[model samples]
Target: MGMKASYVVQPFELHRKRLRPARQEAAQSESGALKKAENLAKRMPGAAALRIVADDETGELESATILEAFGEVPDDFAESLQGG
Candidate 1:
């Protein structure tokens, strides 16, 4: 029942006039995630850094927080992340 936190960078690409999530990248730290997302945004349509906390044993996501967004991120990006 341990809770583990992870940082990730999610990049968005425009496909068929819709913003789609690209392959996500795992980061070592929050700062690393932000830096990676910023760099990726320069090359892609958009990128967001996130902090995800989950139950390590169950592998169930507890929460996801958007650390930062760069460029043209989707309007519902945060809601999408939180699965709302």
Candidate 2:
């Protein structure tokens, strides 16, 4: 089985009172991804939110599972990641 791991920083921009994907980065670890996201967020001209997500390839290239999430994550995000 082939397994892959990656950390992603998903930046959200506020528009019309809703958040939208603005920019993102993929890193080797959660902290690294979060740091990159924060730097990008600081450069953005508007208000934004950065989310750190851990993604792991479950031997299936078409699908990836989230192992953990942090920073302005949704209430159900973690729960869903946990398979609850």
Candidate 3:
């Protein structure tokens, strides 16, 4: 059976808007995870630098799943970081 015009028009009658999370909720979101990690890095300079390797695709990756590639920096690495 053919659909009625009302059915087709129903979608157009609606207004869609993006919803941003509240400050507390946003702070808990994944986007905030990176910020949190950076703050942690500042406090724990001796701690391993955050390193995460992900295969291209979709889905979630846990914190423990992320690779922690850190340790002895090359002599030049520090100089390079200082932009010299």
Per-residue CA lDDT of model 2 for 1-84, tens digit only, reads 444555666655656865455655567775676566666656553222223333344433333444333334344544543462
Return the clash pairs for model 2, or none: none
lDDT for 1 (candidate 2): 41
Model 2's number of clashes is: 0
- Model 1, 55: alpha-carbon shift in Å? 0.7
lDDT winner between 1 and 3, please give it. 1
The prediction achieving the highest lDDT against the true structure is 1
Question: Model 1 residue 21 lDDT?
Answer: 94
Once fitted onto the true fold, the runs of candidate 3 whose alpha carbons sit more than 4 angstroms away are 1-27, 46-64, 67-84
Model 3 TM-score, 2 decimals: 0.25
lDDT ranking of the models: 1, 2, 3
Candidate 3 has its poorest 10 consecutive residues by lDDT at 5-14
Assess every candidate by TM-score: 0.93, 0.47, 0.25
lDDT by residue for model 1 over 1-84, one digit each (tens)? 899999999999999999999999999999999999999999999999999999999989999999999988889888887783
Show how many residue pairs clash in every candidate, following the order shown: 0, 0, 0
In the order shown, what is each candidate's alpha-carbon RMSD?
1.2, 5.9, 22.2
